[model samples]
Target: MAVASNYLLDTGPLSILCSFPLNASPYIYAILQYTKITLADSVIIEAGRGKIWRIVSPLFKTGEIESTTTPKEPEILDLSYGNDLGLGERSTIKSAMQMGLTAIIDDRDAFVVANRFAVHPIGFQDWMVMLSREVNLPTKMAIEIVRSSANQFPKMFLAHILKLLSE
Candidate 1:
């Protein structure tokens, strides 16, 4: 179960990750151990407006996460038509499409749009499960991360993942 060497992250996953302390930043580090992460520059600018910037900025500085300028292609803009997908989502999908990277997007609409564009996408929850199963991330830490990010997930799905971790 080899994960992609690099993944393009959208704002939702980035914001959820902000809950972790920058000093520790365990999950991001754990993920980094298995795969590289690239953020669209638009995500940095969009996330800068909130607490997410506090975490994303330092990781960028430390070289734990990389950033890329969004391509100004019309295809990137085309993904947003008739949808509420934001700049961050569009950029991530576009980057993933062009760069052969997986799009790490958690928003349902963005997930569907990414698929429509033939770009592979993984939700945060599935990403965590992969980390646990493939990367051997500790069950306790996986449970904690999932619990902390519960609001972003469906209740039944959360329960299922918790059960899987507990097994």
Candidate 2:
């Protein structure tokens, strides 16, 4: 489906955001301040693992993220039939479809399937670009954040995106 401007949070992106500046970046939460953001309890559960709850709670308290109820069983079942995905990813996709919001997921498998459901999927690098553009962040800073992230994605992947941004 076409990617809408608004978004729903998934575990991966949200987890990384929690490590960013706000103690919970959800960068879109900060970048798309004027846009509504949706989150399901499932994503919360996944994100809350470890010390993430400590960092993520305030964003909810301050109204940076809007919580969504669980998806109806039939809808969730229908989504599950074709793919094996986590509850958080499924819930994010369901919420995205129901709300017409983009699914802010970072997993390639889930992201590809989300598109088949006609919901747009946004990735971490996409937000990195958004922050870079919105704040006119120096290329160096963007590169630093990606390289320094605790996620430790991969050297080649980072190199590709950094090179793309440079070009």
Candidate 3:
């Protein structure tokens, strides 16, 4: 079966790249190459001038990162009200819904909202699984990447990833 052709990443994934010393996640890079990865202008702004931007801007220049405007749905904003949803997350999800693409968000509330809209929401572990299938990334390397990104990732989430890799 072919993988889905669309993916929308929230700031979490970008933050991971910035916090980790390793290069971009191979799985995410593969998805970008094989699928249409959409980014709201807000997300790009959130990913300001940093190491992540330094690496990602080239991809944008090369047409890998596509910029999009926010959606005009009132309901989408209503969904985000409870959580302290930032502009980037709100805009990213709005764009994903507008384009009928999957939203890759690690935030629980965002995932819930995405699900309500019938938009697929994938988390970090899901991406890791995809990467493991697409490339021969050793479990050790994956663990190291997660460990290095500890500051950006929640301890529970990091422990969960490590446990998954161990198994």
Q: Return the top candidate by TM-score.
A: 1
Candidate 1 per-residue C-alpha lDDT over 1-167 given as tens digits, one digit per residue, 9 for 90 to 100: 35446678898887776766434664565566666689998888878756777666777898878999887775635544536888888888778877888788988888988888898799887777776776676677778788888888888889888887777
Report residue 151 deviation for candidate 2 (angstroms). Answer: 5.0
lDDT by residue for model 2 (1-167), tens: 12224467788876765666633343444444434556888888867556567766776798866788866744744545436788788778777777776677887778887887788787777656654655554566566666656354655577677775675
Which residue runs does candidate 3 get wrong by more than 4 Å?
1-6, 23-36, 74-83, 134-140
Error of 3 at 110 (Å): 2.1
lDDT value for candidate 2?
0.67
Q: What's the CA error at residue 131 for candidate 1, in Å? A: 1.1
Residue pairs in collision within model 1: none
- Provide the lowest-lDDT 10-residue window in model 3: 25-34
Regions more than 4 Å wrong, model 1: 1-4, 20-34, 74-76, 79-83
* Candidate 2, RMSD to the unseen true structure: 4.9
Residue 25, candidate 3: Cα error in Å is 11
- lDDT (C-alpha, whole model) for all candidates: 0.76, 0.67, 0.69
Instruction: Give residue 147's error in model 2 in angstroms.
Output: 1.8
Residue 136, model 2, lDDT: 59
Among residues 3 or more apart in sequence or in different chains, the pairs in candidate 2 whose N, CA or C atoms overlap within 3 Å are 1-118, 17-25, 18-24
